[model samples]
Target: MSTTVTQQPQHSTLGECKRWLRVSLYTIFLLTGQCTATLLGRFYFDKGGKSKWIATSVQSAGFPILIPLLFYSSKSTNHDSSKIKRKRSVMFTLYLGFGLMMIAMDFLYSCGLSYLPLSTFALVCATQLAFNGVATYFLNSQKFTALTLNAIVVLTMSVILIALNTESEDSKDLPKEKLLIGFFCALAASATFALHHSLLQLYFVKVAETGAFSALVRLNFYPMFIATVGGVVGLLGSGDWRSMGKEMKEFEYGRVSYVMTLVWTAATWQIACIGMLGLIFEVSSLFSVVVGNLELTIAPILGVFVFHDKIYGVKIVAFLLAIWGFLSYIYQHYLDDRMANQDKSDDGLQVSKGEEQI
Candidate 1:
């Protein structure tokens, strides 16, 4: 006679529930930070603001945000196994490469934003999702199942629709040449953003053995430190530093208010990144993108109020298409979760069968 001993499953308590709660909150925070940066930048640029160097300062804000994480990472003790993992996972050169790529992505996206209106720029930036999908597949060998394909196609179509809407809306006001320039720069920015993020995802999945939050710290503090320095160099190259204070003082809001906006925007930017890193840590990059895209909905709505953006019928249609694509992607995530649960159940059943035979 064989006695089968069944193991009790681990109970998910309030802590686990709170983890998801935090994820949702973090998503909101990320979106808010992005909106803050975009709007404040618009405010500055719209009113005779001409400091590309400020863009350099904004991204490097990640340097200071990593301060707490530095302490956190230092506290983590690696075991022998983890040490081996680190040896296999980390390459200093790779981190440096990521930072360099970031310099291009940051500078290009800033150029796009500087030229295009907020709503139009946001619409153009949506293409990054499609770029990220392609990059993830190539870089991480992430599979594209039918559901993924459906969502991606929908998103692609939505972006096309948004571009059409942009053409019809305010392209007349902006110089045709500058509009084209913004479009191309935004596209390039999307591409670089995709490559940088995909590489980071690879780094985390393959090499980083630390906990999510710890890895988050390292991602910002390490690659971002170099990226920030590169930005400073880029700023210096542009010869914008000497006139930065002059530009700040001349801002319509007064120097104190302008300085305050930068500080506030920088703080929001850091919080937003923390939220993004948190989501990427808790979930996945694709999921983080979905959460990030939710900003598209928010930014335009806020743009109406802040930038006095006029939303026409074509934009409405584009907005609807965006919602459709987002829903499709979200449904895909649900399908993935269900399939994962089914696999676990099948494994449990197989184990039970073996126990019965014993």
Candidate 2:
């Protein structure tokens, strides 16, 4: 009996260690993949890549990388009958709907990246938390804690500060109209991203079970496949396909760099998506977005060095406010974790007392 008690604690500790290790790995993937992908994306535009469809296409065109993982996951979980039980037509519709949404979000983001400076774009993206809080309230039925509300307000202030800083050196060359377009497009993309996460969480709750890694692959794979196809159609329909050779030849870094930039952008975005999905599966959509927002901190700092993005006084303050808001959200999660552990400990104590009485 003593051995059993000792082994139970050790086993529980091991399981927790494994869970945290997984979360840490996922966080690393999310941070590195997203920051690198964004930088590469901005680099593409800076170096003469003009087709937004091409940019959007590359975002999901790397779905092929997920294929091998899908195959492995399928082989490992073939006996798991608790998979998606919906009709084929229904599943197709869901995939199509999500695919179209992904296309819209990607295109909007591409537009933002094309017109805005990378640092401003990253700061604008922080508004996703506010949009996400709203979506979570309506779709996921999540209540807002004080910390979350504070995060929403503080993040909004960060964006407002950016908006007021019109004399920013980054925007000196950009026409006001284009700046407005970039601002609104980035804002729309942020809201769409939030909606996507909430709806995905709802789908997971109502129709799908999140038990296997294969489930994560499928959730990403089909929608990305459709998005890739849509991107191709748009590229062709827009006649950008014809100019691809000219664009590459004129690229500042030469043809090889052009191709490699798009390729790596595609690869890194997929890596980031995998990490984002892993977090959503492991925790909640809100938690996933919080980790994603961490990129806001890293990307801008990198932008200063790579792109020579100006971090003037107002922008710096805005950046600090963004960090403050993110920390508030993190603290809330820390408190929740503490409460959960306390509950688990109480339950274990009750079980032990019952065992002793018996």
Candidate 3:
């Protein structure tokens, strides 16, 4: 009797599968923490807590925990730093510019949160993806497709609808002038963030290829500089120097347990979420689009449940449209992947036949 033989597909290693599982878990948790920190930072101002205190306290405490992890990861990578030597003045200038922009953006954004609802803030911030997409295409020569345009439009609509319908439960009077100023600030922040991403893609990637520490330092030096400067300026400019000093002193010594707890959550999420997404991208080529769409879809869902932000009819419809647009992009990608795999298999088969004949 003749028996038919079938090829079993090559599966990813158990360790690889486990790694991806861990990444997924980390991603979900990190996203939750990120969204929570963002909402907390925004809501605090509404409740009479100072925005400066919230931003500084949360970020300062949150970053220290992740520093060790980042250091450890940097050490583990075998990349060497000698190849990335740049003139000290050039590096300093780059970071100085970067830092100033970061400080300005953060100050503006944090100030905006004082007036904007959590949902409204998130929706406006969501425009970053669209901005990034356009910027990437022009700066990096990344190709634009119909799906990309559709995704951008859908995301923009989602943000606009959410912003227009935003309600204030307390009905407290808002300083409209300040609020408008804050909105422009947020818009400026978004533009800066987009520009920063493009610059990193151009320069930071090259530095990272030499050493992770160099990359991290290069990436963060400007932001940290910006934050420190802004925080100091904010503290000094608030008029109650004594109270600001006292709060900062208490913050340094860890007197604020509740705030510290929140900071822990933020730090853990920041490192783990970013690390996991990086790992996912390393493992799968299409991880970029997956991560982008996931963020756009999940963040608003989080806002709805965690903040008691309502998803009205227009928002619901807009969100559905966004999802549909993402699905279309994914489907096209699937076809592309299938075709690539088929071509690879054909090449392998031809190589095997040539070897057999020889």
C-alpha lDDT values of all predictions: 0.71, 0.81, 0.54
lDDT of 1 by residue, 1-358 (tens): 1222233122223444566687778787787888787777667677757877676567655467668768867678454676755664445677688778877788888888778865577667887888888888788776777766766666555555555655555543678899899889988998787777677777778877767667777676767778878888877888888887888768887888877776776777777777777776666666667667656655665777788887667556656766776677667766765586567656766777887798
Better of 1 and 2 by TM-score: 2
State which candidate has the highest TM-score. 2
Estimate the TM-score of every prediction: 0.84, 0.86, 0.70
Order of all candidates by lDDT, from best down to worst?
A: 2, 1, 3
Error of 2 at 1 (Å): 7.1
Give the range of the ten consecutive residues with the poorest summed lDDT in model 1: 1-10
Best by lDDT: 2
Please, what are the lDDT tens digits per residue for candidate 2 over residues 44-155?
Answer: 8888988988989999998999989988887877443433454557778988998999999999998997888755776688789878888988888876799978876776
lDDT of 3 by residue, 1-358 (tens): 0111113113323444565575565455545555555555544433334545346534433444546655775677674355335455666677677667656666666666656655556566666666667676676565556775665666566666555665443233577786676677677767676666565555543334544343553345345644566666666677544564355444433446435544664464355335433422332212233344345455556667866766668667656766676566555655655675567656666666677688
Candidate 1 TM-score, true structure as reference: 0.84
Error of 1 at 156 (Å): 4.2
Pairs in clash, predicted candidate 3: 99-222
